[model samples]
Target: MDHQTEVNVGGPRMRPVQERSDHTALVVGDFLYVWGGYRSISGEEIFFPSDEICIYDMRSGEWQTRPMEGDIPPSLSGTCGSYLNGSMYIFGGCNDNGHSNQMYCVNLLGEKYIWKNFTEGVESRPTPRDKHSCWVYKDSIIYFGGYGCKQIRDVHPNSFTIDEASWAVIGNALFRFWGWNNEVHVYDPCSNTWTEPHTTGSSPTPRAAHASATLGSRGYVCGGMENMMMDLHYLDLESWTWTNIVSQSAVPQGRSWHTLTAFSPSSLFLFGGLNLFCEPLSDGWVFDLETAEWRQFQHPHQDKPRLWHTACLGLDSDVVIFGGSRDYRMLMDTIAVLRFPSLGHCSDVLIFQTQPYSLLRLCEDCIGKNAEILEKQLSILPLKLLEPIQKRISFFRTAVQTDKKITCT
Candidate 1:
C-alpha cells in the first residue's frame, strides 16, 4: 500500500486527513466502500461529499477516493444502507436543508458504477428520517427505528401492519414532534414499495442510532438512544416476532450510535457507543447466540473511544471499524482492526510472516518486474505478506500525525 501516492478520480482529490461520523461502510468482495458521513473541523460541521466514495482494497491495502456519478444523493449524514444482490442501497438521511425519505441504489456489478434514484413516484414510504437502522433479509430491507419529524403520510392500508403490542407502545406518538420510532417498514425491491410489517410480541421502544445485524432468519437490534436505550431485541423474520434478550452474564451498558456486527452464524461483536450521559465508550463485547451470553472482548485498542462509526465484517471475519467521533465534537479518520481468535483460522504469529518493511520491498520488486501481471496478482499474495503490508501502511499514517514530525516507534 502506497500511503504517499495521491490519485485524482475526477473533481478535487479527497483530503487524506478525512474525519467522519454517522457513516456507512460495507464490505463487497475484497473492497470496503465508505460513504455518507460528517466531520467537525474546528467549529464547522461538514458533511462528506456524497458524490464521492472512499474505497479500501483489503487485499492490496490501498485506498481510493473516486467520484460517483448518476443521481447522487445530497451531502448528508446519519443515513442507513444495506447490500443486496450486486448493489448497495442507501436510504433516509439529513442534509443542510432537512431530512429525506428518498432511496437510492448504486450498481456495483458494472464497471462504471451508476447511482439510480428509485424513490421517484413512490406513493407510500417512510417519513424522512436519519440515524436509523436497516438490514437486508431475504429479498427485502428491514428498516427499523429512526429519528424523524412526525408527519402523517398516507399508507397502503392493507400493506401497512404493526403488531398489537407495538401499536400500543407507539400509539399516537407516531405523529408527534421530531420523535423516534419503533415502526417496522419493509422495502421490497421487486415491488419497489414500502410496507409496515405487522410484528408480534413485545417491540422495543422508539429509538435512534441503534445497531442492528441479521443472522440467518433473525434480525438483532441493540443499544440506541431515545432516552438512552440499553435493551436487546431481535425480530424473527420468518415469524415477525420480537423477543427481548435477557442475559445472565454481565452485558455492556446501554448506548446509542454503537455497532453490532455478526461475525459468525452463532456470534456477534459489539463495539463503542455513547452511554446514558452521552459519554463515548471504548469497551467491546461478544454475544453468543446459542448460550445468550455476553463476554468481554479483549483487544489492544480498548482505550480508543468511538461512536457513530461503521464496523464491517472484513476478510477473515475481523472487525474493521472506520471513521467516527470520539467525543461527538472531534471526528476521526482512524481505522482500527480487531481480531478475535474465535472468528479467524490463522493465529496472530503466523498471519504476518516477515518484517513489514521487507514484505513491502518484495511486493514492490514483484510489481516492478512484471507490472501488469504482478499488480493484479498482488491481491492474491499470501496472507502472511498482506498483514504486514497493512501494519507498514499504518506506521506511515501514524508517524506524521498532525504535527508533521516523523516519530519512529
Candidate 2:
C-alpha cells in the first residue's frame, strides 16, 4: 500500500480497459460493467444504441462482453444504475428523441434483464430525465436531479421499491435548498423513505453533474459545479444534516461530472471531471473520515484530463476510474486504479534541527493573503490557534489552485 506510487492494474497504458467509444459504466461485485453509448464512426460521430454490455473483472484481470438479453432498453447516456441485493436497477436516460422514463433491472445472480415501464399510473416517475443519479438504498432505487428536453430540472427526488414496483417522491417540502439541484438521493429501506437533510453554514452551491457515495450511515457529496466549487460536503444520516468539511491539503479543482466513490467505510475517493473553466481534470483525491481531511493522491500513470468519467470501489481497497469525455471532440476509454495506503507501519524520522526563519518566504507565493496573515499570527501564538489557522490556509491554497493552471506552450 504505497501512498505515492500508482499501479496500472490491468488496463491499457494510455486508455482505460474498455474502449468502445460511447458508453457509460456501472460497477458491481468485482467487475465493472459498461453499456451502450455514442462513438465516432467513419467521418461522423455516430450514436450506437447498443445492447452490448462489457465487463472488466478486477480479480481475474480480464475483460468480457455480452449482448444484453431480451428486449433491451434503447441505447442512452446519463442513465443511472446501481446494484443492490444481487440485482442492478437502471432508470431514466436520454435517447435520440427525448428523455427516457423506462426502468430496467438485471438480476446478477439469475443472469436476466427485466424491464418495467413506469409511464402509466404512478405518484411520480421523474419526468423524462438524463444525467440524473440513482442509488439503491434499502430496497428502493432513489433518483436525483438531471436534464430534460428544455432545462435541467431538480424535480422532487423520487424512489421505487422492489416490492411495490411503484415510484414515490420524497423530501418534497421538508428539505428545501435552491440553485443547481444535482443531489445524490439515498433511500433507507428500513424507513421506506428518502431524506435530503439540510446543511448548516454555506452549503456547496446547488450543483448538478457532481458525484456522491455513501459510507456506513454517512453520505459524501464532492466536486460539482454550480458556478464554481472545489469543496466537499457530507450528510450524516444519523444526524440528518450536512456539514462542510474543510479540506486539509492541496486538492483537485472545482469540477462537475466527476465521480466520488467509497472504497471502505473510512476511505472515500474522487477522480476526473471538467472544471469551472470547462477544462478536463485527471487528478484524484482521497478523504479520510477519521481525520476529516482530504489528501490529493498523485497518479503517476493516469489518463489525460477528462470529464463525464465513471469510477467505483473495487475489491480490497482499490478504486477504478473509467472512460469520460476528454473534450467536446474527444471521448476517453482510459481507466486507472488507486490502492490505499497502509496505516499499520510507522515511519522512523531522524530528528534533524529546527529553527525559525522568515515566515515571509513561506507565504511568498501563497494564494490567500489574509489567510497567510492569519497563519503568521498563529505560528507565534499557542498551539490551540495553530490547528484552525493551518486548516484555513490549507483550504485557501486548495480553493485557489484546484483549477488555476498556467500553460506554457
Candidate 3:
C-alpha cells in the first residue's frame, strides 16, 4: 500500500467485536450475515467459530447477534458461501480438527432460522478444502479451485454435455490444475450432485483467495495472489471460457483477503486487502465490467486498511464492510459503509466506454470515419460518456507529453 492510503471505518455501524480475519460474510435481504473466522485471544491466534450468527441490518445500521437453531456450524475459516433463493449455502472449510467437506444452508428470510446439513445424501462431493471460491450460478453453486486433501485441479463433466454419466466418475474431465486448478465444478442444489464441466478456453493459473462475483452468465474474479494477481478473469458459464480484463489507468495492486462486491449490475467495488509486501492496503477500486475498465477509488479519506474483510452492497449505493485485520491490529467488530456518489443517469448514453479508450489507442479509425457517422455518434454523447472520454484524453495527453507509456484501453 502507498503512504497516502487510509482505512477509517465508515457508515453508522459502530459496535466492537473481537479482532478477526478470514471470516465469511454475505448479504441476505436487509441483513449482512457474518460467520466463522480466526480471531486473536491473549496474543494467540485461534479459530473462533461459533453458532451465534452476526447480523448487520442495512436499514437500521445496527448489529444484532442471534443464536443458531439447528446443527450449528463449528468454528472454522476458509469456507466460502453464496446467497440463492431465500437461503445462504456454505461449503467446506477447515477447523481445528482438519478440512471439512461438509455443506450447510440457512434460510435467511425465515422467522426461526436454523442451519440445515445439505451435505446429506450428496454424491461426488468436492474434496474438503478451504480458500476455495464458490458462487451461485442459477440453480447450482459453482465451485472453483482451492486447497484440499491434496491440490485438486480438474474440471468436472469436462468438455462434453451433461449426460447419463455416473456421479462416481466423470467423463471428459479436463486436467487444468496439475498443482493449482482453474477447473470448474457445478454442484446441483436440488439433486445434491457435483459435476465437472469441460471448459474450452485457457484457464487462470491455480489460485486461491481470489474474489468472485456473478455477472449474468459470467463470473468475475479479481486480485488474487497465486503470487500476486492484479489480473482479472471472467468465466463464461455457458462456454466455459475465461476472459482477462486488461484496463488502463492505475489498477489496484494484487492482494488477497480483499473483498469484491457487485454494487451495481454493470460495476463492482473492491476494497482493502494485503499487498505482495504484506502491507495492509487501504486502496479501493471500481471495476466497470461493461467497459472492462478498472477505476481506482481513492482511499485518502479513510484511515484503516481492510484485509480479509467482506463487503456487501446495501441500498442507496452504500458499501457495507465488515471486519478484517490490518497488520498486527485485529479490527474492532465495527461495520463500515462507504456511500458511492450517484452518477445520475445512463438511461440514454449510446457510446461504449471502451470506444473512447479504443479511439485514443487507434486514432486512424476515428479519422477514417465519415463526418456523418461521427456526427451522429457525437450528437448522443451524454454528459456521463463525454466526461470520462475527456478525462481519458487529458490523462493520455499528459502521459504522451511525459514520455510515459499509455496503457489505456
Candidate 4:
C-alpha cells in the first residue's frame, strides 16, 4: 500500500471584507472578484441593493473594494459570472422583485472600471431566470440550466459571442432537468455555436445545482442531488463521451448547492453544501482523477458550513472558499484557503513546464513516498538533468513539523 502524507499548508485566515455578504466568487488572473448577496444582522435578513464589488489580491492577501460603475444591475442571487479577455460578464439573477433578463459587463481594461449595459440588444437576451451555470469558452459566454417561473427551463441553453455581438440558442430544445444540470456544454467562439455530442455509455441523469470544472479537453461534473445521487461523471471534450467513475469511501455525503473547482485535470476539490436533509455541510472532498477516487477533508473549524458559497482555484493551487448561508443567515466576508502543499516545493523547478499548476502539485505528492527508490532506479545522467529533488525532502520535513503544530480555527 502507498503511504499518503496529509499536511495543512496554512493556518486559518479570513478575509477582511466579512461585512459584505456574497455567494459566488471567480478568480481571474491575479484578482479574485466577489459579488453581492443578502447580508444578515441582528437576526434580520437585509437585502443589499448596493452594487459593491470586492477584489482580493492573491499574491498579497489584500482586498480592495469599489462600487460597480455605470448602469448597475439590481442586487440578486443565483446569478452567474465569468471572466474573459480582462472583463467580467454577469447574467440572469433573481431579486426580490423577480428574475432579471438583463446582462452587463465590467471591463477591467483601465484603472477605472467601466460597466456596459446590453439592453440595446434586448431582443437577443435569454429569458429571465436564476440558478444557472455560466462559463467562458474562448470568446463566448455559455449559460445552461436554471429555475424558470413555472418549471425549470432546459430548452434554452444559450451562448453569446462578444465578437459577433449576438446571442443564440445552441443545441435542440431540451427540457430542463431538475437538480443541477451536470451536462457539459461548450461554445466555440470561432463557430459561434454549442455542441452536445453523443456519447457511448450512459450519461448522468439530468440535474441542476451541481458544479463542473474544465481541464484541457475534458470537463467534470460531480456531487449534486438528482433525487438521491452522490457520485460523479466526466465528459471528454475530444471523444464527446461521459463516464461514471466510482468514488472512494471517504466521499462526501450526497449534497447540492456546493461548489467544485478543477485546479488541474487530476485534482478537483468540492466544498460546502447541503446534505439530503437540507442541513449545511463544511466537509471538503478532493477527487483524484488519476486514481478515480474521492478523499474527504475535515477541517478543524465547524463554523464555516457554507451552502451556496463560492469557490475558485488560485494561481498557487490554493482553493479559496467564500461566503454562504450560516444558520439561514447570509455570511458576509468569511473566507478560508486549502493550500496545496506541493506548490511551494515544486514551482521553482517546474517553472517552464506546460502542465497545469495543479498537476505539478500532484506529482510532488505522488513522488514523495518513493523518492529514494526513484533516485536509485534512474540513471545518473537522467537524475542529474532533473530538477533538484532536495525540495521534496525539505517539504517532508516542514510538513511533519507543521502537522505537529495543528491548531483549530
The reply for model 4, stretches above 4 Å from the true place, is: 1-22, 41-45, 119-126, 150-201, 238-240, 248-250, 329-409
Per-candidate TM equals 0.75, 0.61, 0.68, 0.63
User: How high is the CA lDDT of each candidate model?
Assistant: 0.69, 0.51, 0.60, 0.54
Q: What is the lDDT of candidate 3?
A: 0.60
Query: What's the best-to-worst order under lDDT?
Result: 1, 3, 4, 2
lDDT winner between 3 and 4, please give it.
3
Which numbered prediction scores highest in lDDT against the true structure? 1
Which sections of candidate 2 miss by over 4 Å? 1-22, 41-45, 149-204, 238-240, 329-409
On residues 11-74, what C-alpha lDDT tens digit does candidate 2 reach at each position?
Answer: 2222223333324566565556667655444533344444556665543334455545654677
Candidate 2 TM-score over all chains jointly: 0.61
Better of 3 and 4 by TM-score: 3
The number of the candidate with the highest TM-score is 1
TM-score quality measure for candidate 4: 0.63
- Candidate 4 residue lDDT tens string, 36-105: 6565455444555446666655433445566657877778766777777667677766655766757777
Writing each residue's lDDT as its tens digit, candidate 1 over 1-409 gives 3321322223334444366777778877666778877765555557788887877655444456777899988988889988888788999988667678999998755555679898989977988888888878889999988866653463322322222333334445664335567788899987898888789898887778789999999999987865454678999998899999989788788888789988888988888887887578878788998898999876555556777788887655667777676674323211111100111111000011111234545564345335445456658868876565554454344333433222111
